[model samples]
Target: MRRAVIALVITAAGLVPLLRYHPNTTTTAIRATAGTAQTPSASSKAPSTSGTRTVTGSEVDTEFGPYQVQVTFNGSTITDVQIVEAPSDRRSQRIAESAAPTLRQEALRAQSAKIDTVSGATITSEAYAQSMQAAIDAS
Candidate 1:
C-alpha cells in the first residue's frame, strides 16, 4: 500500500505541471482535428514581402526536440510562414513530412499562429503553434 501510494505521488508530481502549462494563444480558435498532408501547390505564393516585416519565433522545446518558425506580416496580417527549425529524428521526419504541409496550409488559411492541433502529431503541433505565437508577438 505504501509503495503504491508513493508511485502514484511520483506520477502525479510529474504530470501536474504538464497539465497546468498553457502557451499564450496567438489566434482565436485552434481546432483539434485529423492531421493531413496538404502541401502547397508549386504556383502558390505567399504574400510579397515588399511591405512586410519578418520575425522569427523563439525555439520551443518539445518531447522530441526543438521547434521554431518565422512569420512575415503586412501590418497586423500574417503574410507567410516558414519553419526555421524542428526535430530531425526519423519518427519526427516522417511525421513532419505530413504534418508540416498541413500546418503551413492551416496557418495560411487562418492567417494566424492559432491552428488546429494535428491528431497524430500533438506534441509537434503544440510546439509549432507556440512558436508561431512567439513570432507574431515579436513582429
Candidate 2:
C-alpha cells in the first residue's frame, strides 16, 4: 500500500509541471496602407528606374510576429520581392531567414501571391503571401 502511495505521489509531482505549462497564445495586429513607400533595408535591392515601381504591402500580424513585404514591378511584371518586416524572436528569425529567400523566388516566379508555403515556416509564409497579395492588388 505504501509503495502504491509513493508511486502516486511521484506521478502527481510529474503531472504538476504539465498542468502549469501554458503555450503562448498572444497575438498582435498591425496594418499598413498599400502603396506606401518602400522602407530601405540592407537586403533591399536597388530600384529599377525603367518602367518600374515599388509598392509596399500591408503589415500582417501573426503569433510569431508582424510581416510585411515590398514588391517591385516592371510594367506589370513582378521583378523583385523583399521582406520588409519579420518576426524578431530567435526561433522565428531563424525560420524567416531561411524561408524568406525561397519565398521571394516563388513570388517572383508566380508573379502573384499564390506561392506555396515554405516548409516549417507555415505561419510566416501565410503572412507573407497575405501582405504580398495586398501589395499586388494595390499596384
> Pick by TM-score: which candidate is best?
2
Clash counts for all predictions: 0, 0
Clashing pairs in 1: none
Question: Once all C-alphas are superposed, what RMSD does model 1 give against the true structure?
Answer: 12.2
Q: 1-139 in candidate 2: lDDT tens per residue?
A: 9999999999999999999986877654444434453453333344433477778888887876788888888877888988878878888888888999999999988989999999999988888898898777767
How many clashing pairs in candidate 2?
0
Reference-based TM-score of each model: 0.60, 0.69
User: Per-residue CA lDDT of candidate 1, range 15-125, in tens?
Assistant: 999999865433434322223212222322343334566776777766566677777777567778777777777877678667888888889889887799888988778
- The per-prediction CA RMSD against the true structure, in angstroms, equals 12.2, 5.3
In candidate 2, which residue ranges exceed 4 Å CA deviation?
A: 1-22, 27-50
Q: In angstroms, give how far residue 25 of model 1 lies from its true place.
A: 28
